[model samples]
Target chain A: MSSDILNQLKDVVLEFDIENAEAVAKKAVEAGVSPLKAAAALTGAIREVGDKFGKGEFFLPDLVCAAEVLKKALPVINSAIEKNGEKANKSLGKVIIGTVYGDVHSIGKGMVATLLYVAGFEVIDLGINVKGEDFLNAIKENNPDILAMSALLTTTAAEQKNVVEGLKKEGIRDNVKVIVGGSPINQEFADSIGADGYGATAPEGVKIAKKLLGIS
Target chain B: MQKGFKRKFEPIKILSSSQIEQIHSASLQVLEEVGFRYDSDKALKLLQSNGCAVDYETKIAKIPPDLIEESIIKTPSSFMVRSRDPEKSIRLGGNTLYFMNSAGARYCDVDTGIVTMPTLEQNNEGVIVSDALDTVNVFPSYTPYFEIKGVPPVMSCPVSCAQRMRFSTKPSRGAQPTDTFIWETQMAQAVDAQLMGCVEGAAPLSLAEDACNAAFYYLDAGFPIYIASGSIMGGSHPITVAGASVSHNAELLAIVVLLQCIRPGCGIIANNFVSAMNMATGDLNFGTVAVALHQMAYNQIWHSLYKIPINNTGSAFSNSKKIDYQTAAEKLPLAMCSALSGANLIVLHGGVTGELAYNPILAVIDDDVASTIGRIVEGFDINDATLDIDTIKEVGSTGTFLSTKQTRTLWKTEDYMPRVFDKTSYQEWLAGGQKTVIEKAKERMIDILANHKPRPLADEQDREINKILSEATKYYKKKGLI
Candidate 1:
């Protein structure tokens, strides 16, 4: 019965059904199933969705939907695992992603967040038009392993450097790795701003996240 | 007042008539079978009520060919765009051609080649330069590369529009009609000059909410809407130029149909900013021969069949991050093809790479190119005055006509003089400083900025425009946008 609940949970994620995925996750928890193992299966399912996306068989909306389902399912499983005196270590790492202030472009940041989540990272998406203070607060609260920022406009591209400088001023620069990206961003800009890495695309963003976390 | 040139000769056809037809039919099929998504509820409902099959959950609409055909018939082939000064206004069909500069270029890195946002003063200076160029029919909204000291982006539009109106009397091209400021800017423009609303169509056959709102607003306002559809090949479209053209046309036509539905006979200019994708870097390459081919194809097809004015980024919009050899090579062909393809309006002043940055010096250089292409497209006349058969006879074999009456009378009209081109011989050119084209362009830029005086807006009109801008800022601040 527990195995059946787990399989149902994974299927819900694969089908990108958010409500069902959450409900099935709760069912697996009620059935005394291993939450971490179920999460692993869901992660595997999300990875399959990413593979389909990379292969051009699926569009951005499809990948986004699948990620949303997995995102909804994760909390339910995490709470149940917490009740059992166990930690949810199924995540490869934690990341905080947002578009810098003065820029409201959301596509690039959302793409990176989705890809990173699919690559087994716990992503805290801060959305668009985020200020420098917000990045510092998110880093302080979440203590994430990576901080990814995107700026689509040249006007706001400088804010990426501002966020890094803010981190330095707060003495938290070494606590998290910084990744800057967007259509206007390049390696020179990234290095100028002292970013740890730069990703030109969503897939490349995932690779950068994994590399930063020392994951193969 | 310098009005732009008109093409008296035939446009070069890169694609045969049948190929254009096949592409059109294929696009209609794609619309009917594999409909694109529309992010606007208003558009979806409007299309559905108008005989389209719409899936509400996915917001996808499959439009029938009959509806598109019916809508196309209502669209006028030509219209006039008025300016504050009637003399500066332009007609938008036939062989008439116009040139305009770029708007909202955040950076001006001409000296150090280091990208940095421009200040409002620098932006104003750029406007002065654009006003001085005889080739640019209309000025563009001049925005600082960075945010102004106290103004938010949402409110920057009205300020920029007001500033441009104050400094230059030429009609200005509207910036990003997708923004809410476009509404505010239009409101400010209503009191004075006319603006051609710039609306971009989302690729892969979709129309997002902002784009839809912008299109509807301009069409409703009775202003000419410049509908630009940018399709990055292999990203949101097919890899091949022909296939990308098909997708680009579909996207443009879908919006055209919607515009016609909103208001039949509304003025619109079709623009396709198609480019290829660099697979290795995952970057959309704007400066490429393939992109030039796509621009030419779209220009020819739209002009030949639709019988309306077409806008193209033919002379500008490159992928080189810096102004270098690659930038020149890529921009030249695209601009030449655009002029030859009979594009009615081509954007001549723009960025070096991917429209991410702007350099006014490039505009000066491109102005020279526009002058040259203008002469080429004019095609030499066989009329007696131009043919000068009598003059040829008078001069004969080795005799000189250097002092002839014809030479003295028609010299200005007969020869195309470029402002930035080096006419001096090699030794004299070196003695004059051996300046590169960029350096010569800079000298002209400095001269224009220093001496050219744009016709100023009336004092009362200036006060009224500033009041409108202040109101817009207050409204946005109330909404907490600032």
Candidate 2:
């Protein structure tokens, strides 16, 4: 019976049925299946989705929708696990991300946030036109493991350096790793700005985030 | 005012006749059953009055097959776009092929590949270089850069249009992201020019109010319309090429029905900018074989079946960050496919990094590519002036024809001499510093900038453009968009 419920959870994610994911998660909980087992099933299914994406069998929208299904189902499973007096392994790490000041471009930052969430990271997106003070405040409040900044315009790209400088001035530079990315950014820019890493694309950004957190 | 290439031979067709009918029937069925949403109340009313089943609340318009067929017949097969200089006017239909300048949001340095927000001076320089290139017959909407430094986002379109009018006399297209088409029309009228008004559709069967409004305003001003529905496969559209063709066709046809109903016999050119999605990276796979196939199929359908003028944007960009061999390899196949398959206007020069950057040096190199493709589509005359028999008898097998009258008179016309390609001997190349194509392109760009000057606007026309720009600034400010 537990196996049936777990399979149902996995099938829902694989099929990208966001509407039924939470209901299926609730069903698995009521069936007395371990929330950990159900969560593992979802992770496995999303990994399969990733594999299909890599193989070109599935596409970006399919990957995104499947990740959304996982996102919708995980909260229900985590809440049930908490009710059972258990800790849920819900996140690889916490990441705070945003597009820097004076740049209203959000597509790159938004894609990185979604990919990180799908990769088992808890992402808190600060949204576009984010100021350095807001980054500092969010870091102080959320105490995230990594900070990611995106600046699509060359004029606003300097804001990445300013944010890094602000972190140093606030004396929290050593607490969190910094990752920068965008069209105008490269390894040289990242190294000059004292950033920990640079990602040329969104998938690369997620991989760098994992490496910075010492996770797989 | 360049005489664009004409395809003397029959165009290449990819889809069978039955397959073309299947896609067309599928689009008609989708239009009737699935329906499309028009956000404008005026469009819904107009569509409903024209026998479409429109739900005002949902804004869905289900057009019938007959209405679509009748509209297709009503659309003009060809039309003329007038330029400031009458010599630069172009006809966008039939076998005539024209190349338009591609657009990007930022300017890339020729040597460094660093992209930055373009200043107004840099934008003018891009337009000047485009004007100097004979292969660039028309200018696309948002020509060199989408956004210029020190210009308000709300005013970028009008500002870009005004700059294009000032720098080049070529016919330009107008965009309406922030209601800039109103000012664009006025600026065009100020210079006695015409702007190809753009009416773009949102993907997955929807038309926004801004686009609908632009169509009405442009038609009222006696200008032709360019309709496009840019979609990504596996995202807003189906993944299969045929399925994407059906969906893209239905989206553009919805606008076609709307336009023909409003003004019968109006000129319209449907544009195909559909791109395949990179599933692994979740980015657009620009200049891919899938996109080229889609364009080839689209060109055949639009040209042979629908008898409509079509524009292909599949070669407008590349996924590569810099101008390299990857950029050329990725861009050329789609361009050649589009040309051979009968695209009326192709957006080809200066775009890089998938619409993120532009470089004038790249445009200079693309001129050679465009000329070569144009020469191929132009084909050659078979009826010989002398049958070459008399000339062959005059010069025996051992005699040299290099110095013959036939060679001297027809040498320049017989073959295309590329402006930037190196044709020197190996030792000569080594002696001349072994300059690569990029270096040669840079040198050519510098020469054009220094020597080639586009026709300047008259004082009265210049003052009128400035006055219209000032009025647009105030208008956007009043609307809180500036």
Candidate 3:
């Protein structure tokens, strides 16, 4: 019976049935399935969706929808795991993301955040027009493994360098890997600003993030 | 005037006759029931006199359907805009198609991708480049950059008009933002040229006072008016294309009624610049399928149904920052769709980064795109001699037609040779350093800048333009805007 519920949970995520993801997760918990097992099913389902996206069988909206379903199911599983006095499921890493200061552009940053979450990274989005001080504060509070910055305007792209300098001044630059992206950003700008990497697009950013942490 | 491309075939129709009538009726209902706000007292008085139900306090003019149809009929089907050089004047209706230079706020570097405020010299170069391109027939208002170095905001329009007049003989459009049209009128008169007066509308069925005043001024000057009301889908307009089309059509028709009432038989080109909102980012999504459908539907209703000239500004820019595959992928489809469906003038060339910047190199590359679209719409001839059955039989079986006189005489007219796009073999491309289209565009831009010289203004006309610009500078300085 537990296997059945777990399989149902996986099916909901794979089907991108975001409406029923929470209910299925609850049923798995009530069926006495381990929260770890439920979480594993969701993660496996999302991985398959990601693989389908890679193979061009699924599109961007499908990937985003599947990730949204995983997002809905994971909280119930994680809370249950907490009640059982167990650690939550493993993540690739935690990433702090936002559009840099003076730039309110959000699609590229939002896409990066969604893709990172689908790649199994726990993401804390700071939203748009984020200042260097705010990024620094989020870094200190979250202690995330990565800091990703996005700026769409050439006028505002300088703020990415400011955030990097703020990290260096706080003496925590080594604590997290930094990846910068946006329309105005390129590899040369990333190198000049001492960034760990630059993504020409959102999918490439995911690959660079994984490589920076030496993850497969 | 240059003979623009003619669509030998019927325009592509996206809406059934009943659907077109449905949209038209809905638009009339919105105009009659919801009523469009005309902020100017003169406009209100004029509408009230023309049998439109007007509320002076609310500034809403509820136009009746008969009056709307009558006003649309009063507008001329086509009109000529005179340029300093007679050869550059362009007709703005019928089956003919023309290209206009797009506008941007800043200038982008071709190699480094850095954007900055354009200098006056760079702005002049942009105009000259547009003037030299074969496909660009008209200069849109604020043709290269909106802001140039050392020019205050209020004076930018007049200065840009002066630069366009001095550098290029093409017919230019006029803009109104704080009495600049007054000076633009004087400058155009100084050169014996005509300006396509721009009277734009604010979205959600409203016309601001400045735009209304510009209409009065341009009408008094006897220049044709270009009307546009650019809106965002799901924000300022309805989310669905069908719903948005009703609102967009209603907004434009309101202006048409006002212009026709102000001056009957005036030339007008209704522009459809509506764009979709990127729901995720809250920015304008240009060159999307939604925008293309909107333009196509707008073209059908205005061109085939109302018999009015139309312009499409949806192809002007892209969300992509650089001249990459994304830029082309975004721009070309909407442009082609506009050409196939009935557009008299298309706003294309140089616009990039969602109207944030313009690059002359990008304009050089877009020249190729514009020419290709022009050639496609100007469909091939289908006559007996051109069919060349005799030549085909003469070169029967294993023989080639490469040496035929028909092939030699007709290949140039039959095919479009792009100015910047590469169509070389792999070995030839490698031998030539495999330069991409952007590199080829850079070389072309340099060549034009070095070789191309636009018709110079006569000494008296140059002095007259200088005198008018000085008067504008002094007028704005007294207003503390300079």
Candidate 4:
């Protein structure tokens, strides 16, 4: 790719250039770049930002800015991809997520939701301490994909099972994939309670979701 | 080196302003409106027949002193709580002391406070830190369920004990009174009766009176009972130091009274902290106020009255990294207070975040520090050997005391001998990778877990211990608590 196209593509991911994505797309076209190559360039930029943030070279503020830049850049990139109709990461399906009952903590569930959004999946965040029936109601209403449950406190971790059991009670156990995460929980606990998958943190949850989704 | 006696007795510490009131209120409430739940139908019937208001729906019963007096009278005074290991028996009464770790630290800091991750590494580090402290007799904190659940959940409590228990035998090592696999230690304790408390159905002081009563019931069973009263500064009691302290002491005292009543002079542990929550939010400080307010004052008062031992959230409860300034700032005072106040058992040496967590080498560092702290409290005799005035007077005119016999005799003992500290020069330190104390501590942990062979259990003893735990676990399984 030409320098101008590369710069625009880099800005798309680093600066969350979704708003500028159309201009970046035009630049890519001007440089005779295929949508596939331009998309690869965007993914590569995100990876670099993630690496820098992980290494402390970039911090949370940097991450927010970068994500915003990507947000701004996505439409232009998406239009180009749409025009070309190149097959990239489509939806890894949809995920309905929330913290279990009697728990107001949101960080654990929030992280998982953010990661899901970033990893090219649709996420519906249901807020905190959702009752057992609520999860089932959402799943039935949305008819999306996976059901992700989170609980940071030990007292609340038990509620994850209640949600899963609620699904069973509602006669929709096998209809959706199930996953659990939190501070006090472990994989064995998830298994014992019959959860389909477990993750220690949000990023890990995304990875687990991918595995659960059979997303290669 | 001569193993001399180190006396740590805190006598001046009395209840803080809030502590006095919280207990008074809690007691009045207990006696009046908010009665207790009695699981046993027989116990319930006894209470109901004796003018107690029984709520069958809630399984709660409130009784008068007249009805409780008989049951209270039947409870023994001066029961021994035995350690699973025959060698770990301890007598609980009068000036006797036992220590335990500070527990359930808050997750996030309010202002400049930083939140932390609860990991296995942090938990083990806490045990190591406690063993490293000088005055601490016991180290109890995090649920090392990770290691215990897999490796030897059977030895979960035991391994936690072993983390710091193997240190100098001068102080008896005590473990948490967990329901899981702890009966092994209790059975083994039949020999000496040294182990301590169990969860009183959720709250710290929940079963203090009953536990002490039960242990005393089995007094003839050959175990000393230490009635330990625990209070969560912000959660269970109050957020302020004064309020938390009062609640903690009052509850501990009530339980202590029961122990004393059961066995005239029984062991009592008063556990408290000045844990304050940023009320606008729910954030709480676990350590800063713990040492400054609660432990310091507690050890002083308890020592003066009954030679009582004190349990506290020590340096391990700090909200900082490793043995940095924060750890020293939070821990040193608590240790000194224990030493000076004569607290028989000062727990949570290298512990962190109010003993809800730990750092491994910190354990060794704490142990090394307590040696110095122990010495500070011990003071010294102006004897001929210690004074060395003649030698000093002669050498004063010249130079070094290196050649002197007095120096040769005492120098080694004078310093705080570190189990995992590097005292080498900068150049040598560089040669050794210029590691801080934490690095050395981590190394020690790996060595201990890998090289050390924990003392094993005997056949009959182990069998009986397992039987007890299995029986208890069965009850829990039935209740779905496990």
Clash counts for all predictions: 1, 1, 0, 70
Off by over 4 Å in 3: A1-216
Best lDDT among the predictions, by candidate number? 3
Error of 2 at B132 (Å): 0.6
Order of candidate numbers by TM-score, starting with the best:
3, 2, 1, 4
Per prediction, fnat is: 0.00, 0.00, 0.00, 0.00
The superposed Cα distance between candidate 1 and the true structure at residue B437, in angstroms, equals 2.7
Evaluate model 2 with DockQ and give the value. 0.00
lDDT, candidate 2, residue B132?
94
Residue A198's lDDT within candidate 1 is: 88
Over the stretch A1-216, how does candidate 2's per-residue lDDT look in tens digits? 989999999999788787798999989988889998999999889888887866767656566678778878998898888998998885899999999999988767877887788788889989999999999999999999999999998899999999999999999999999999988888889999999998877777888998988887
lDDT of 2 by residue, B212-289 (tens): 999899988889999999999999999999899999999999999998877888999999999999999989999898
Of candidates 4 and 3, the better by lDDT: 3
| lDDT for each residue of candidate 1 in B149-190, tens digit (9 for 90 to 100) | 345667566666776676666776565632654544554365
Residue A81's lDDT in candidate 2: 84
Residue B159 deviation, candidate 3, in Å? 0.7
Model 4 regions more than 4 Å off: A1-216, B1-5, B8-136, B139-147, B151-186, B189-194, B199-222, B233-235, B238-242, B260-265, B314-316, B321-324, B354-356, B449-451, B463-482
Q: In model 2, what is the error at residue B115, expressed in angstroms?
A: 1.0
CA lDDT, every model vs. true structure: 0.77, 0.89, 0.90, 0.55
